[model samples]
Target: MGGSATRSAAREVILTLVVAAILIAAMPLLIGTYTLTVLVIYGMLGLSLGLIWGFGGILCFGQAAFFGLGAYIYAISAVNIGESTLPMILAVLLTAGFALLLGAMMFYGRLTDVYLGVITLVVTLILFKFINSTAGPQYVIGEARLGGFNGIPGFQTLNVPGDPGAYIWGDALYYVCAVALVIVFLLVTWLLRSSFGRIAVGIRENETRMALMGYDVAARKTVLFAIGAAIAGLAGALFASWAEIVTPTLFSLGQSAEIIIWCIVGGLGTRLGPVVGAAGLAYLEFVLGQQSMIDNTLIMGLVLVIFVLFLPRGLVPAIASLWQGSVGAFGRRRPVRRMRRARHG
Candidate 1:
């Protein structure tokens, strides 16, 4: 039964990826490349938080810290090294390392969940303030200067592997972001099907029970947190490439809050919920941005409230429930119809 379940999960992931590939190929025809690209990056960012918070039950309020770190790290490194390949790698690894350190401190210290959230939020605020304060001319890292509120721009963006001069932008960058998001989605799905992932879920469900069952819950949580950070870092790197800039606003409280909202609005425990939430809400925000008649934050707050009160399971799970109910009703009606025909005959 276990093996069968694993196989089923694997098949589901494969099918999902195939569908994602089709959408990636088709979406460009329907939406502007720039809009789609930003949505893809945001979707990836949402997935990172969803994985750790939804599956591992680690509610990190500072995910944007990792995201901002990734962008800044990549920008700084790319500027110094004059190539993007190594900088992107550094962005992911260094961000993950930072998360691991922070996670270890929080988990092993036996901090309460509330405190964990507070600490993460505080850390992000600190980064935001510190980055903004670096406007002075002396604030320099190698060839790159921390431009403070102005942000770091004009850095080398993503390039084809083994060729630094072959810059990827516009449609190529959009495709790259879409493909990367899909790959991360697949990897996260596979991780959730693995033993470690199962253990992490169990820990999320009942931490005390898992601890009693000889699992090192702290270590597992720390590792999961780091993995999530790594993913956010990758998304940040992609965003940096697309925008060609890195700024302190990336670590702002608003950015962190937006990520949580995405996961909540999408569906907490499901894999696709975060992506759907991120893309849908982001597109909504984009549309709202073009109009001055409505306040974006007010609109988002209202949406969050509505979901929390009415559609608590989020859009995906709510839609899934409706679909299942309709299918079941149809099946039941078919059997009744067959019975009636037999009786009539």
Candidate 2:
């Protein structure tokens, strides 16, 4: 049964990836590359939080800190190295390393959920303020200037491996982002089906029980937290490539709140929920940006409230439930119709 279940999960992941590939190929015809690229980036960001909060039950309010750090790291490295390939790798690794240190401190120190959230939030604020203060010329990492709130712009964007002249922009960037998002999604799905992932979920569900079962709950949580940070860092690097700038605003509380809102509105405990929520809400915000009539934050708040009150399970799970109900109803009616036909005959 376990083997069969694993096979079934693998098949589902393959099917999902096939569909994603088709969409990635076809979406350019429907939406502008710039908009789609941003959506893809936000989707990855949402997935990062989803993996930790939804699956690992680790609510991190400082996810934006990792995101901003990744962007800044990539920007600084790209400026110094004059190539994007190594910089992008550095972005992910350094961000993950930071998360590992922070997570180890928090988990090993036995911080409760509330305190964990608070510490993460405080850490993010510190990063935000510190970055914002780096306006002076002295705040230089190698050749790259911190630039304070003005941001680091004009850094070399993503390029072909071993070729810095061939920059990836416009539709090519979109495709790259789409492919990266799909790959990350598949990896996260696979992780959730793994033994380690199952243990993480178990720890999430009942930490005391898992600890009593001889599991190193703290270590597992720390590892999972670092993994989430790595994913977020990757998304941040992508965003920097697309925008050509890294700024302090990336670590702002508002950015962090939006990430949480995306997960909540999309549906917690489900992989696709955060992605869908982030894309949908982000597109809505884009539209709202073109018009000054409605405030984006206000609309987001209302949407969050509505989901919490009426659709608490989130859009994905709620839709799945409705679909299952309709299918079951049809199956039941089909049996009744067969019975009626037999009696009539």
Candidate 3:
């Protein structure tokens, strides 16, 4: 039974990869570069949140904190360094380190889920306000000034790893973002199939039980949180490069809420659900923002409510469940038909 289950999981993994490949191949042909770039960033943010909240059972409401931190770090460092390579690395590490510290404080305190969520939200808000107030020249970090609400602009954009002269932008930037998405997706998929991933999920499902089973629950959760933060940071770094600016708005409550909404609407606990949700909703938002006929917020809220009421399991998971049910029904019918033939013979 264990071997059979393992084989089934392997098959699912291969199937997922094939589907991803097909979708990615079709993206450039279907979507314009600008929209695709935004979608890619949103997808990465969703993926990061999905990993922690869905798989690790961490309800982080301040995910945008890490996202903004990464963007700011990248922008500042890139401005000073005259290239993106080192700054990109710095962003990921700094964000992950911050997550580690934050996670340790909460996990070690044994904070309830409610408290955890509140703390995260508060943290995000604090960052937003603090960054917004840093408009004075005294708020400078080396060559990069914290322009407060105005944001830091004219920073160095991303270039190739070795050759700083080969700036990545336009169509090339779009493809880079697409490729990054694929790599991160595959990496997370692989992680989910590993022992650490299984243990993390176990911790999520039952922390006490995992502790009794000799696992360091707090440490594991901290690690998972750090990983998620790192992914968000990567997304933020990319966003900074794409926009050539890092703003306090990146840490705004709306940004954090949108990340959660994307995860919930996409399908909590599923690998690709959040990505799908983020991309789909971001495109919808883009379209809605372009027109002045309707109240976009009202429409979005109504849509979210409808999804929560009608499709609680989310789009991807609901479709997956239906597909599995049909397959199961067909398999059962095949066995019954075989039995009938044998009896008749």
In each prediction, how many residue pairs overlap at the backbone (N, C-alpha, C within less than 3 A)?
0, 0, 0
Instruction: Compute each candidate's TM-score over C-alphas.
Output: 0.94, 0.94, 0.91
RMSD of 3: 6.1
For model 2 the TM-score comes to 0.94
Instruction: State the lDDT of candidate 2 residue by residue for 15-36, as single tens digits.
Output: 8888998999888788899999
Residue range with the least summed lDDT across 10 consecutive positions in model 3:
336-345
C-alpha lDDT values of all predictions? 0.90, 0.89, 0.87
- Misplaced by over 4 Å in model 1 are 329-345
Deviation from native of the Cα of residue 114 in model 1, angstroms: 1.5
lDDT of 3 by residue, 156-193 (tens): 89999978789999888988888888888878877877
RMSD to true structure for each model, in Å: 6.6, 6.6, 6.1
